[model samples]
Target: MSFEELPHQADVRVRVRAEDCNVLFAEAARAMFSIMYVTCDEGEIERRVSVTSDDMQSLLIDFLSELLFVSEVDRVVFSSFDVVITGTSLTATARGEPFNPAKHLGGMEVKGVSYSGLTITRDGEGFCSEILFDV
Candidate 1:
């Protein structure tokens, strides 16, 4: 897995493979380390989990919710994520600035993943997918 910040944009680029969660999580953490917008104790976060679902929409919701749950509990906001899907499961890892309630700027609130603008289909090699977040 790998992530890089776009120099001119406010977005991050994420690439990840589905075989392992540890590698993906580490890459996400590294990407978060590069953010200049927030602060927190790097040692506080200690657990990671891989979420699985039958479809892309559900997988996306599950993945983002995991991140949101951590942020709300730890008061951190992640800025980047990489997701990979295999079989009926999804592996996602994320990175973001540490949570600082004192210096806090609001982060995005993601509702559950929606079927709107969501698509899943098979091409020659394998399945291809795209989804739009509610933001």
Candidate 2:
């Protein structure tokens, strides 16, 4: 799985490519956290998250949104995800630790995931997704 930051006018955009749906979702989460400069070196906590949407794109948005909410409320940053996607539903175990200001450098504050320019499609034998984040 791999992801790269794309140029955006006011927000942050990321393009991700993976071997399948599950890896795509995991890579997207990593890209989002990377944008925020969040790193979980020594995981001290684990959270299970599940989300269902009408489609894969929506499911991805909801999944990431849940992570963002958890980060905000629990004051933690997740760096690893074991994501499973079946149809329009997603379930995953996220691992991370509490956000320590001294260790985790704060980057751009992502407000929410956006639907603009969002795309998820099959590319050859794998899958690719593009997401825009509101910063």
Task: List clashing residue pairs in candidate 2.
Answer: none
Which candidate leads the pack in TM-score?
2
The deviation in Å at residue 134 for candidate 1 is: 4.0
Candidate 1 local accuracy as lDDT?
0.47
For each of the candidates, the C-alpha root-mean-square deviation to the true structure, in angstroms, is 6.8, 1.3
**lDDT for each residue of candidate 2 in 1-135, tens digit (9 for 90 to 100):** 399988988999999999999999998998998888655564879999999999888899999999999888998888888999888998998888788888888687889999999999998999999999998
Residue 93 alpha-carbon offset, candidate 1, angstroms: 3.6
Which pairs clash in the backbone of model 1? Answer: 32-96
Task: Provide the overall lDDT of each model, using Cα atoms, as 2-decimal numbers.
Answer: 0.47, 0.89
